[model samples]
Target: MKTMRIWFGCSMGLAVSMIFGWSYGFFAALLPMFVLVQADRWSTPLHVQLVLEIVWVTVQVSLLVGFFQPYPLLMTTAVAIMMLFKCVAMQHKSTYLFGFTGLLIGSILLNFASYNFFDIEEFSINLWMCGLATAPITALAYFLFPEPECATPQPVTVNNEVTKDEYGMVRQAAMGWTVAMIAYLVFNLVI
Candidate 1:
């Protein structure tokens, strides 16, 4: 059942993207599919997902306009600040805040490197459309296929100290930053 939901969500995303246009269909599909999967795993609320998507778009635009064009130093500083915020947010167990934002940043950086930073309007349109499409699909999937009951409730632990999970989040942030840095360097070198 879970697998089916995942498949359906991905398919819906792809279909919507294809309807929008073939050139960016795959990339458009990826964001929705990723959000759907993560929402399932984390049990994130719809409102939260919506907010995250908005933030993701805002960040993408900021990077493209404010930093990616004429200010390398500002871009570097912005990336660093974002990475630090992601790490801290994760350590505080704010997964939803960091998860989508981190992914958005990394994806944008990597894609920018590969495709150059032209066509910002097209990219933004695709991303916003995909994000809007995700909401309905995600809501439908959750409503139609609710999570199954578990046999036993897992024990919950509260610890002030950093745990393995927190460490993993930090590592993820670091890796994302590293990838962004490499992408920026390659982009500069190539262009």
Candidate 2:
């Protein structure tokens, strides 16, 4: 059942993307897959997923117009700081969301640079539209196939010197930083 839901959502997203065009469809398909997987693990609400998508689109636009071109160094520094902050603040819960956002922003910036900077406005609009399109598809998937409840939350056990939870936190932070750096590097290389 779970696997079916994943396939259904991914196929729908991919179909929608193909209708829009190749470039847009790729992300349209990809974002829903990411969201569905996260939703399954965390049991994140549809509203929260939608909110995150909005935030992702907003951050992408802001980075492209306000900071990416004019102050590339400043933009990269700010993204690194923000990613680190989210890592520390949200810990395990935010790992996927923050990391994915960083990658998305980086890719968007890279695309803009590779094409024409003047198209930033249009690109931002298309991204927002993609997010809007993805939201409903993901929401429907979650609605159709809900997550199973755990009887009780499991406590993290100690491993080596650190608790499993602490180890996870560190891993999340490292992942966040790595994504941020890769995105930054991509942006820098393009522009």
Give the number of the best model, judged by lDDT: 2
| Poorest lDDT segment (10 consecutive residues) of candidate 2 | 41-50
- Per-residue alpha-carbon lDDT of candidate 1 for residues 54-151, written as tens digits (9 for 90 to 100): 55755554555555456766665655565555445544444654555554544464346345445655655655566566667666667777778789
User: Where does candidate 1 have its weakest 10-residue lDDT segment?
Assistant: 109-118
What TM-score would you give candidate 1 relative to the actual structure? Answer: 0.68
- Pairs in steric clash, model 2: 17-25
Which residue pairs of candidate 1 clash? Answer: none
What is the TM-score of each predicted model, taking all chains together?
A: 0.68, 0.65
Quote the lDDT for 176 in model 1: 60
Question: What are the runs in model 1 whose C-alpha is more than 4 Å off?
Answer: 39-47, 54-60, 90-93, 105-117, 150-162, 165-172
lDDT of 2 by residue, 1-191 (tens): 56766787888888887887745456666667666766564244543654465566566546644655568676667666655654564454545565455455545554455445356555556566666776788777877877776799978886666345777778877886787668657755866
